[model samples]
Target: MMTRLVTDRLMMRRAQSTDLEGFHAVVSDFEVVRMTSSWPWPADRAYTKTRCVPINAAHGMAGPVLCKGEIVGIMGALSMYDDGPELGYMFARAHWGQGFATEMARALLDHVWAQYDWDVIKASAYDDNPASVRVLDKLGFHEVEPTIGTCKARGGDFPLRCFQLPRPPLTRV
Candidate 1:
């Protein structure tokens, strides 16, 4: 089944090869990938091609985020992680600060929680990425701790902060 999730102005679905050029355009921007943990700087079309392989597979539920028919970014969860369900999102620089990430993330979280029996969702942000932190905070995620994380693209360790949003208690039938 093709996984799809929608929000007010965003549509997230299985990423396709068609997304490579658009995806590369965003990830290649230095300012966009600077704070991202794993994205390589100068992200070429070849790199985007390689990355789309797994996203198209059935592994992580990862997909592209679209706005008005254009791929703006990617967002998804690992389905399940050691700590819990881990959610992540990335947006093109041009779309930053428009609440698209927040809107898309909220929609995805709602879908996952409703369809599964998960207790908490986890996420992380580089210390310098206040935008991401704000999105998670507005989603009701509470800060957990600060730790070191390697940004392969930057070839260095940066301070990363973790956050978690616990599922609200269920009501009796």
Candidate 2:
């Protein structure tokens, strides 16, 4: 499996059994989970270890983001029909505003661009998540359209702000 990445102030690596609880802490945070894309898992260890680890990935691989050694977030890509792959990320509340999300996004975008034939990398956020939109925009992604996608956290369709990028930005977050 693809593993660790080091950024300016972060160390992102593969998820581990030990990280389930910390990762779940981020999942339990309403603000973090609520502003994300698609299905959001409740804070459950069994689910996190059993169902989430094996399946919660962009392709067949994913790695969590750690700030100074704590599992503060995660990053990965989920491929779809003919649209290349979409990038996703979520960090814990205490870790916000620190550019960790942008740093991870920039790193993951670089990794994906190096290994895939993708013409684009897409991402989305709730319309109200300016921080998320700002992160994507800083990574050179632009608004495409909107979507009412499967949002397990909300238990139904939720509105999403879509953004797409042709390639990874040259800048490293």
Error of 1 at 68 (Å): 0.8
Candidate 2, 1-173: lDDT as tens digits: 64667788888766667777777777887777777654365655565565245334446346578777778887776574476688888888898898888887777777767666677777888877789899999999989879876666666766789999986455332
TM-score of each: 0.88, 0.83
lDDT for each of the candidates? 0.80, 0.73
Once fitted onto the true fold, the runs of candidate 1 whose alpha carbons sit more than 4 angstroms away are 54-60, 80-83, 171-173
Q: Which candidate is the best by TM-score?
A: 1
Candidate 1: tens digits of C-alpha lDDT, residues 74-145: 888665445657888888888988999889888887777766666777899999999999999999999997
Model 2, TM vs. native: 0.83
How displaced is residue 173 in candidate 2, in Å?
22
Q: Which residue pairs in candidate 1 collide?
A: none
